[model samples]
Target: MTHRYLKNVVSLELDKDKCTGCGKCTEVCPHNVFIIENGLAEIIDRDRCMECGACANNCPFEAVTVEPGVGCAAAIIKGWLTGSEPSCDCSGGDSSSCC
Candidate 1:
């Protein structure tokens, strides 16, 4: 089954203008969040993204960018376990205080 996070919360972005249709994002994404269509990469399911930053790191043309471990998987899991609103603590504080 496909896993999806909170709607409209993921930070994944794709710059189609910079994409080279190299399919690197498609290959590196663990969640299958991207797909190549019409010779360009498209965000098929933004919520499916875990904000892992693998796609961005692998994109040779720097077409993708995502703030990894910010407010997606870790926050969702923490919310599920604590029965509270999802929070990533992205206050730009110490790294140990985040997520």
Candidate 2:
């Protein structure tokens, strides 16, 4: 699947030392951001991540760390201008509170 991306703002840190190569991340990622090879889960496409928190939530070994937020400059600017909280609509507005 081809996942669209605006920017790579999601803070994803993969600790290979903690990964068990379970491929669980691959299964839960909607954007195909993770790939398992040589008994390890590698971040093949960090930019494609939508910060949905699925990979981190599903990982049993807690190998994946994701901050789960958006990088929308327009939303941020709008929030500042409107004096409201910035939120990302991707995946769901509730996932990323970018104000």
User: Which candidate comes out best when scored by TM-score?
Assistant: 1
TM-score of candidate 1 relative to the true fold? 0.68
List TM-score per model, in order: 0.68, 0.66
Task: State the lDDT of candidate 2 residue by residue for 8-90, as single tens digits.
Answer: 56688899999999999999998788988998999998888877788999999998998864457867776788787765543
Candidates' C-alpha lDDT: 0.82, 0.81
On the 0 to 100 scale, the lDDT of residue 57 in model 1 is 84
Clashes of each: 0, 0
Put down candidate 1 lDDT per residue, 48-92, tens digits, no spaces.
888878998888998899987544666677678889876765334
Cα distance off (Å), candidate 1, residue 72: 8.6
> Runs in model 2 with CA error above 4 Å?
1-3, 69-99
Clashes of 1: 0
* Per-model root-mean-square deviation over C-alphas: 7.1, 5.7
